[model samples]
Target: MKSPRVLLCVRQNTLRWDGEPSSLCCSSCCVLRCFDDRAAAARVNQHAHGRGTRTSLVRHGDPRVRLIAAHRSPLTALFSARGLQQITRQQQSPATQRRMRQQVSSEPQGVAEDILHLSAWLARQPHLPPVDDLLLDRFLYNCKYSLSRCKSVLDMYYTVRTAVPEFFKHRDATEDSIRRSCEVTLAAALPRLTPAGHRVFVHRLLDADSRRFDLLAHSRRVFMLVDVLLHTEPVLGAVVVLDLHASTWAHVLRAPPPLLRRLAVCFQDSCPIAIKEIHFVNAPGFIRKFLDIIRPLLKKKLNERVHVHTGGLETVGKSLPLHMLPKEYGGEEKSLKELSDAWQLALERRRDWFKAEELKRVDESLRPGAAPERAQLFGVEGSFQRLAVD
Candidate 1:
């Protein structure tokens, strides 16, 4: 095994950093060297943390130049981590940027540095799409600031997006069928977080007529609500409410197996939303039968988190704030009609944003493999069941 080498390329004789002393270089204010002890890499990364700083530190074996930068070497892949920070600032307003900076500053040391490193790693992956730091920051928080888990989640996220195109693509909210799905199921992220600081999302069956339902359209609308919720709300996790008051067999039987399999794939592993608890209320006898049929398909951890209420909203009310819930569910909040309408309007306003996100799916053709592994993901039948139970 060879020692890790750090190579630096500078454009000046003296290097300066904010609140730090200058270090002298050589040969027209430029210096390039590869070392074995790896002492220089730590200092290089420390200086690279300064704003608007430019320095190339590449690791190679046996003291060789392994693509430091365009100036010193042929590889231009080594980008300043400042690029990621600039993206975060450009996307947010002055107020939001300041807020984010303050939040990061309050965290333990090296949090921001790890986020920048995560963004840099994503940049090097040829198959992945670009993501803003805001989203990455939330994902880091979701993973408890663990870089390895964050990377795995992001990888599955984009890969699953490609494999499950039906839910992710064509997310325009103005379509008639999509619009109907919204009205049929009163779905929205409740305005108030639970006592534990988890966002509360509720789904109720408004239109009892099962014949009017389209599984695909309903699934798409549900995910749309979820996407907007996770992006806008800040919470420790999420608590899902499924109120199945008037659902019938017609609605349950209409869901196809393939679609259920895809939904399971995205919801189970692809999504970054951490579901704290799932509560079922106003459930009927047949609903249990449906759950029994699909029970074997769910993961054990998820199955353990599920709760079927035998009483009223009191059980759910204990989990969520009463004043923030819909009045129908025994809370002091607005009625489901009011909350759903507000969310529907919000979704309409974000139609353009959702359309833009549809283009973020991975291009499997360009993936560096003989063939993408997507076919095997959805190829098995009866391996998945629908959590989209109305």
Candidate 2:
């Protein structure tokens, strides 16, 4: 017995899993170049085996290799749902995953190559608008630099802005409603990143009067901050710290299904932001009711990421980056108001960018086929729909 074979998640669409072409790997990696070509498969088998033969098995255990019970052999089994995705992260442990995200790629060559490839692809698409290299890099980073996924998302990214005008339009920071929403609700991007390179976003009501709440406007303001982040921040992902301590039943009632649908579309679908986790701190008595309305709107995977806590921030501190949080929530940073004001100033400074971006949207008429229909995208009940933004 020489040695145990190993399972490799081959990179790109040009070759089968773990072959010579594109030897680099992915967690959600690999696809067969041609399932019908026996010659090609045999060549891959020969290339991997020392004696130029088709091997029946790879190693039984690799933390990177996540397996399922399949009728097919191991070679073909890698083609299962989990193995075929473009984004990796098969069966990695929590600590391992955290370390992976925390480790920023020091090598700029790979990123530079990815940007060039992505930029070329972007140029070929007639319907898509011109995207800056920085924005393209952001998309590439979020997709784990998967060119295929990045291209697919870039299409939807512009399409969503055109489709969901309610959330995307009128994003001017100085406007009275937008400013008023900022005053009543603190939807500020925190100054610090979690140990895993995820930016912390705080959402809460500064005003107890539920009557003052404008869910859409409040949400628009929140989105404005995120727009600033997508272009400026280079974090691996985001961890949302939603403090509902000051909320009431009236606030809960303000979240109607339609508004929730559009809002969900904006957060979950449009932009290329990876939400690592969502922690609801100081959850209220009616948190269940609120979840009941919103949970169904979210994707199954996203629904699993939602966590609710009735206790104080201390409970959340166990998981979230409490040390980086503002003093109001138990941390070393400045108070929440000061942070909110700073973000407000930041948004105001970019006032012209928001104005200019309003002009950019998919000219559906120029699209190759029929424009994406509202009914087809989201049901009649929803003004916006969730795309594969994550």
lDDT of each: 0.60, 0.64
Q: What is the TM-score of each candidate against the true structure?
A: 0.69, 0.71
Worst 10 residues of 1 by lDDT: 67-76
lDDT string, candidate 2, 354-381, tens digits:
9998888887787766677765556565
| Deviation from native of the Cα of residue 306 in model 2, angstroms | 0.9
Off by over 4 Å in 2: 1-107, 382-390
Which tens-of-lDDT digit does each residue in 1-390 have in candidate 1?
332322333443123322111232332232222223354445444545543456454343324332121111111123322222111112223453344334333232244466679878887666779876546655776666767877877877777777777777778778898888876787777665455555677788767799887878877887887776545433346788888786777778887656666776677766777777888888777778777765565678888988887555556656665666678767777777777777777667788989888888776666556434554555455543222110
Candidate number with greatest TM-score: 2
